[model samples]
Target: MTKEAWDGTVTKKSRGLLDGSSMYRRLELRLTDGSTVKVRVSRDLWDAVSEGDQVTKAAGEDPVKQ
Candidate 1:
């Protein structure tokens, strides 16, 4: 499917850690239009975001290039 940008607020976040450090992360968002979307993200980007933070991201894209 084609991808598009969507604005949303982060609703949830989680991480995968290795060796006592975060290696991967994921974010779940509630879209402005009231839809839910989830995306896997890098640890750096994940660290930069928090619950209730507004963000823009491309939908239908793998790896969620925020």
Candidate 2:
């Protein structure tokens, strides 16, 4: 399970909790090589994205909105 691909813009969208009952969804990207990454997504791709909204996650799939 090591497949990775990226393209990004969405500069933050978040939710948290991960040992206090487990809940998580996050995206804080700014990639396209200008680095900055934080991704833990699902929950329908974090409610279908927001922030600056331009996203892609190819390898094995699950991020969209581009």
Candidate 3:
């Protein structure tokens, strides 16, 4: 799989069930490139960040708070 990297300010945080069975965490980001996207993240990473926090993900790596 191709790995992608991005840096952005988080706009929102949320959690929900997928198919009423699997739980998931998500972050909505406003990227440095001026686009917005939502990405699924681990529970630890989800708890580590908040709205408006800056975060970065390197290619093939998990996102980290900046």
Candidate 4:
């Protein structure tokens, strides 16, 4: 799956745990545009992105180059 970090707010959230693990998480988003393309992501994914400067997708690739 493609991974990209975005800037979005949690519109809503409910208390829950995944696989009975103590690791708490939530469904967050960082939209690339106001066109409703909110990038669905998890807290784990956010951490990975936070460890970097910018999110990257399909690195060094261009469809037109194909």
Candidate 5:
């Protein structure tokens, strides 16, 4: 199963208008294994995020990156 955890190591973040009233935050993760992954979190998650936050998934559990 895909793991649901935050590694807390954010490298990049972006803000944009998601819909008409809501906003979106895109997070970029630079893993310790020298891999890059991107995740788009809801505004609710914004409060939980900081300068060094990341979202992670398990190796066999997570779907392959496209």
Candidate 6:
């Protein structure tokens, strides 16, 4: 199904360095419909989130590419 926004609760969090410099962060979430989704966000955004936190992202905006 298509969605305009992604609303979910974070279930897991991971962080690492890319190319030994840039930081990368990933979050595993449980959507409202019981589906799991993984999304990558920037270090700044990552710091604003934590496991168990609820978050919403614009459908077309890819956080990972930021």
| Tens-digit lDDT string for candidate 5 (1-66) | 435543435677788877868777777777767777777766665556666654554554432221
Q: Give per-residue CA lDDT, model 1, range 1-66, as digits (tens).
A: 347778788999977764576566779989889999886776767888879888776676533324
Best by TM-score: 3
The C-alpha RMSD in Å for every predicted model, in order, reads 4.5, 10.1, 1.3, 8.8, 6.5, 4.9
Q: lDDT winner among the candidates? A: 3
Predicted candidate 3 versus true structure: per-residue lDDT over 1-66, tens digit per residue: 129999999999999998799989999999999999999988998999989999999999888898
What lDDT does candidate 6 reach at residue 3? 38
Report how far residue 34 has shifted in candidate 3, in Å. Answer: 0.7
lDDT, candidate 4, residue 48? 44
Worst 10 residues of 4 by lDDT: 57-66
Clashing pairs in 5: 8-52
* Model 5 misplacement above 4 A: 1-8, 18-22, 58-66
Best-to-worst ranking by TM-score: 3, 6, 1, 5, 2, 4
TM-score of each: 0.67, 0.32, 0.91, 0.31, 0.52, 0.71
Residue range with the least summed lDDT across 10 consecutive positions in model 3: 1-10
1-66: candidate 6 lDDT, tens digit per residue: 233577788889998886799877889889889999877776776888777888777777644211
For model 2, name the residue pairs that clash.
none
> Candidate 4, overall lDDT?
0.36
Worst 10 residues of 6 by lDDT: 57-66
